[model samples]
Target: MLMGLLWASAAAAEAPSMPGHPEGPMAISSRSMTVKNLDHRIIFDRDVVVKKGDMDLQADRVEVILTAPPNEAAGHALSALPGAGGAMLAEDNVERIEANGRVKVVQGGKTATADQAVYHNADETIVLTGRPETWEDGYRIQGSRITILLKEQRSVVEESRVVIYPDEGSASGGP
Candidate 1:
């Protein structure tokens, strides 16, 4: 179920890998899972947790929106078709993911928290809203909204307040 979410980035990564690489496998658990094949969506409700590589995501509810038609089966099934990385449809299978209610993402040294988060596969972008805040190393930023474009390698925070801790050497006035 989870493998179909980011298989394209892993399969089509000839140059280099993207953030949250689906290199291995993803583990997801929730109070319950609802598979709506007719709607081409999967919903995980209540205390949902998702982990992939060094990234961990937690939310009260998560919805994986698939691009497949109504006839399409569970998204993971598309991963087996032949094509680029066993069919790029695997990529289309998961068009986007929406997380709501206390959404938090932790990857390596970085962490982000918000009330809602949406990840768009085609654009490789993640948008966080509802008092979003992000932190890494000694830097912290809180904003009304945060847009992270992984493909473009940039982040934009609106109405942001940032705090950057000075380096020890710099703080000590070292040459």
Candidate 2:
């Protein structure tokens, strides 16, 4: 079952307007895919990988939920290219995404891993659960849950354990 509710506020645009998602063309690949038009979603399973600009998400299962119906998505999906053998799910029409089982997301030098992740496109945030972990700037954080504010470059961890690593070249193993 999906865990997020994205409001119908995604503007139908000729291109995806999501910031940091370069020109808004997302590429996806998976071992298997299922299209549920009535549900307005595309499901990918088994080694699913989705790439948009510099960001990448990989999981055992992933779902792309659309703001509009399939027909509307087709009309707007020019912003989203076909992901390998999967259906043409448009990037512009994407409202939210849910990833499950061995989910990993990478953007620039930051990396996150979780058993489950939900991407809130409009909110520009990602919430992760099931042993979530984040690594960046030589520091690592792990927790039962994590919330990342993409635009603000901030993260909140619950039941968190943090580890700060020393600089590799520093004397005395300290910065």
Query: Runs in model 1 with CA error above 4 Å?
Result: 1-22, 69-92, 167-175
Taking the tens digit of each residue's C-alpha lDDT, what string does model 2 give over 88-146? Answer: 45655878888999987766555677899998878777788998876555556677877
> How many steric clashes between backbone atoms does each model show?
0, 1
Summing lDDT over every window of 10 consecutive residues in candidate 2, give the lowest-scoring window.
5-14
Best by lDDT: 2
Q: After superposition, how far is residue 138 of candidate 1 from its true place, in Å?
A: 1.2
lDDT of 1 by residue, 55-169 (tens): 7788999887788742464535333222221121244557888899998777655567789988888877777898887655555667787776666545666777765566522
Which candidate leads in TM-score? 2
Candidate 1 displacement at residue 133 in angstroms:
0.3
- TM-score of every model versus the real structure: 0.72, 0.74
Model 2 lDDT vs. the true structure? Answer: 0.63
